[model samples]
Target: MLPLSPAPAWAVAGAARVRPGDAAWPSAARWQQLGEQVGGRLIRVQSPLVACRSEPASAACAQLFKAVKNPYFIGDDVALTQTLGWVDAWTSMPSAYAVAARHTSDVVAAVNFAREHRLRLVVKGGGHSYQGTSSAPDSLLVWTRAMNAITLHEAFVAEGCAGQAAPQRAVTVEAGAMWSQVYDAVTTQAGGYVQGGGCMTVGVAGLVQSGGFGSFSKRYGLASGSLLQAEVVTADGQVRIANACTNPELFWGLKGGGGGSLGVVIRLTLRVHELPEDFGAVNFNIKATSPAAFRRLIGRVLDFCSQALIDPHWGEQIRFRRDNTVQVSMVFQGLTRSEAVAVWQPLRDALAREPGDFVVDSSPLSIVSTSARDFWAPTLVKRVLGFIRRDERPGAPRTNVFWPGDQGQAGQVLHGFESAWLPAALLQPNRRDALGDALFAATRHWPVALHFNKGLAGAPAEAIAAARDTAMNPAVLDAFALAILGTQGQPGYPGVAGREPDVALARQQAQALGRAMAELRRLVPDAGAYVSESNYFQPDWQRAFWGANYPRLQAAKRRYDPDGLFFVHHGVGSEDWSADGFSPRT
Candidate 1:
């Protein structure tokens, strides 16, 4: 490599990253040297959809759109994320260059290069961030997609915890590995379970860092809580092992402290659990004939939930729609189909008695149970039912499958997305009516989906205890559910003629979702929002996302990455930098 260039005058005056056009930007020779250091894994990033700009009618353009709908294809590409962009917030912008890291050393090289050059740095593992943290323009990306590897242990202990901690069955997952792969290995093949994101294609590392949740979280806990150890490459380009008995504070910070803020995690070891015998679901919709009937229905539903479903057995969502419909899509574990039916019998009977006010779907309510191990087994699930969509691309892995419900999020252009954790106190008999009214009014502005599993209330004691130890907001321990209101359009990217995002519709939907969230916030005046799926323009994000834990997380950031080499939107220690994370706030 040639000798380094002189520092730009602007950089000498104040702190700012070296942009592509800056005088201090790395030379082509320098980039090539860094690439060679990583074994030629560096990629000159480019979106496949860029070709559509000049040749809209070409066959290649058609193929690109088709592939955009398949999340597996999106996950495999370093230039794309499951969410293409958020309206008026950000669009997926590929970095100037990316190191497709196949080993921890590659990540160290990329980090050292970024720091030495004073360049903006970004990290991507799952590339599924709705907040657009994984994609940034004019930056160097540490792409860990090629580093995926999974290893299981019958009895494992942290590196420095031989005497301090007991041996437990765990799974060691590489940064690039997805939840689908972990599920297949731990659940389907080994007859065990791993707490992870419900989205099968979501990267394991990102999920754990952002306080992951899943269908069985009520029984298990947040994925962050299950993390036993992690190997991270920090800003100093040093590979550090973090666990309970070693670098314990960094380990806590890595748990629910938000990804891309602390460091690039190369690998993780998560404690796994014994598999349950059965997994079951309940699905149905009820339509009310009048506004008064809808209010009554809401109250009755809340009452029923408080009476029966406030336990570790149930998870998933219950949606309240603008069309006066209540959609129930809930799952259960460790329960027989008959037992599950019996638990819901009273609610069914109450709705039936009010035939004049409410009408249930003609298709009878579905309450079915299946073997727990087959839940994530792609081949077995395909043989038993059409519950998943497989990656049909040539030579795709047989395990590359996602739930049909998650299809719309792949490469989606987001209009609006907002969520608030609803405290379990709202379920009290005295407060249930007010909570019902708030939910009803919120639906008038937009639909709201209450994801029960996202909150830790009503969970097992062990689950709650584990979650409390992480850096996540304490509000989650008492939150009964996370109320979410979001809207989106089809896969579209910016600067693509005739395929650009519909800004007008997006703004309108965003306002509606905001109003819907406002109504719910009236009841829980100080609700905390999940960091991964929160408002892009949240004013007091530090408090809303991490609550009292913000100061501690900031301290950890200063300890590990005091120079702020790692930057993501709203991440810890980000308040000292510019919005783009390229310049110091001063």
Candidate 2:
């Protein structure tokens, strides 16, 4: 790979920044304080137990805000007002109060309390779910980030003893454990590894729900497909287990179904594989000048990906991070750099020369990064690069949104949605500057990029079934298709999700891009399947992505979360938006 360079001349010159606007404050506080006067209950978590060898209450609410008592935060607690994550989420200001849950039992208690009291609740795992479904307007958030538990199973794939160990082995991890933590533990302790871990922090539960992606998926399978068992706390507040033995159908549904379905996953168990000593990592960043080269490059990369599926000795990832920049990163399980060159030579040769007015030196590259390729990819480069758009001058208003989540080992695409304000008034141009500043500020660590499967050609039928049916299922596809709109970033972008400071401008962009992408799909072909993280697929698209698992998954939803507590933002059960003050205006 070539040495990193400064932002290109065009990029530096054309810094088209997007910002957020001021927002109307939520009235939940009034409802909470006022409702408490009546027979109603508004749960305001105040920590009971202080482990500081001091105070006490037998039972305690989550102490997340208190636990995060950094001077950086002023008076606002969960309603954190100043942080970048907070600013990003078009939150009018920082959160004032945040609930903290210490364990799964606490999670269950929180859910039941909200259920019993009729309070709207949002579940937060790693704060990485960029869809803002992880957060909401004046709702009680069930924070699960504190329940960080991770266990790597030795019986699953004992090192130096694959055939000698138990037939099947796995790892048990709490839903809150970040992907980074999981990788650290497995690489060192358990001797196993994530499927295709990406470069970010993530919680397994949310990552799986979004039909996780990774470099390894090209060969082995998706992270969701690795599910063996899971401990879930359902709407009724009952902690249930979903797995092959307990609730096999539901377990299958949970595999690739979107998050917040069936229940809040408290724990996840995944099938583990023996660690390879010589996995491969290769990357090439290219800038194309002519349309011919761009088109040919895409075709060639896709061809390589198609071929890699047949050879376990192969893995390929091609990404067009920007209009001019494209990078193809590949991983090989047993193949060496020499063998990989031979396989990639055809694709390389195709891009050797330029057609007309050739200027930008567009090309592909490959290298061996890690000792054992392990789990790695170039998506992070694109994402991180794209994410570094804003300013750092402490005084500016932050990005209008926030989504917190991490990339799991199976090349999890970490997405954390933050809040951003979208005023009811449409003609507000005053917000553009602030919104732009916020977006730039909040995305320092984020990289807004798109990625897809590189190889899945000649694997076992069951493996293919898992990817198509479970991970890339219809319902999940809907969630992923919408994810593209978030390429600029996640929800809370005010202008996204059909809302905006300038409705007309927003509409124009949406329609234009929608038409353009549709045409592209017809030509070069858009990705048929998408991870649930950026799911934008509607019913038809969902059906197309899933093929045949809709009925089975619906049945599972009925059986497990019969009370309608478990649901996606626009899921089957959540169709009744009217009750929640939402209308189908558009």
Candidate 3:
């Protein structure tokens, strides 16, 4: 990639770097040379398309694309696209847009090119978005596959004493770094860690922006709730810190407003939790079907959460196994298995007393694993996806889509869910099962996972304890927040009356769903809906998952990104955003 020459890392990392030797600043010749010479070593996965390139019209674009290899470069492609896992959708964009960025200057150059050309910009790392937001047609995407740096300072780990969880050092990460990287860095490097926060492969920028939820969430808080600071690149081209002291409002917006609607985020600093010196856990299972069993277990699932234990350690999720059995998973955060057992013993006996007696068939099941990874190897999914192909897939049901960063809902998913304890008022229980069915149908093509965090139930609600349940980040995909929208209060289902299914039923349903969620704040008293998967909800989803923070998020958007350049569906879709701000051409 170099022009028969490569520069040293010092030359690249120096405080001031200028394109040398009269080489084209962003040319294939100079970019490749600079990329190769950049000192920070990286293991890249190149885009498959890079191998089949038309010689760059310009030596600059050509050399720049050539220097990085597919495996070394992460691109947008079938092997990289999640869910459908087909090449057609994958091939539309360079699959595997991974680049080994040596320093900030490189990113600056790439970003400038994208802006000059006015191309849709998608920043990808693990390429795990549910809606394929990281990839788009003809998009000038920056795959942060190489900026996987994590600097952990253990001084932030929180030691829980006297019911108060304290803080420790911080972990600063490049946008490309995966949650798994941060987890490992903090857990192994600091000798302690935060148990649950997000999916292992998710990139930090998007997750934190969308108010990430996780296993340790119930005990400590949501991913964004742990955010200490961030280094964000504004649309106008500036890398500024957004945290408590610097642009605090912007800091708050960055933490929970959801991502993509905003500009590129380069780095993030988050607070980590200190695990008990002897941290350990156990899991239990039961055939989760049959109405009575479902009601009993589902009820206690909330009660167990609502009822404060001697120590705060109770969690639950009812998963419908491919085998048709519902896996009632009980996660407890404790120092020792013995200690965990003491807390879970009652939960186990109670769940055993009932079951998943769902409309679907059922069989009791049980398995205990130490970590969520032992139970599910999310990383292995990538390996399994290689067998799939483009021609082998089906087309989309609808061409249009939404990502729920709307009406201020973004911050909840990104920050508020973890910031404070939402009262039971935020959730309405009776309509939940219906929403589950809706979501199950919506994502029937892909795996549909529903968590057990109920904001409606008191005491130990699921939202209070289900941290580190790294299954889904709905905000990354759809523009809707599921339960928080209006459907909760709609007529029919539970306390409501009837649902007209035919004529423009989609819109009606949307409105109804929006209405229900808007009513949730009344139920929890001071609590807001604990937003988890925002794909099904948004700031406009009044009938869905409503909360108290939506207005503040709206106000912030008005003050910043008023032009709507950084706006997304519900996240920053302030009522004031101009309709002409964006075009649907992309």
Clashing pairs in 1: none
User: What TM-score number comes out for model 3?
Assistant: 0.57
lDDT ranking, best first: 1, 2, 3
In model 1, state the lDDT of residue 8. 31
Per-candidate TM-score against the hidden true structure: 0.97, 0.63, 0.57
Task: Point out the higher-scoring one by TM-score: 1 or 3.
Answer: 1
lDDT of 3 by residue, 264-365 (tens): 677887765555444233334445454344434444544554344312354444443323334444455544556655555676665545433533222222
- Could you tell which candidate, 2 or 3, scores higher by lDDT? 2
Q: Which candidate leads in TM-score?
A: 1
C-alpha local distance difference test of each model:
0.89, 0.46, 0.42
lDDT accuracy of residue 443 in candidate 3: 25
Residue 6, candidate 2: C-alpha displacement in angstroms: 57
Q: Indicate whether candidate 1 or candidate 2 has the larger lDDT.
A: 1
lDDT of 2 at 95: 16
Q: After superposition, how far is residue 198 of candidate 3 from its true place, in Å?
A: 3.5
Candidate maximizing lDDT:
1
**On a 0 to 100 scale, what is the lDDT of residue 448 in model 1?**
91
> Lowest summed-lDDT stretch of 10 residues in model 1?
1-10
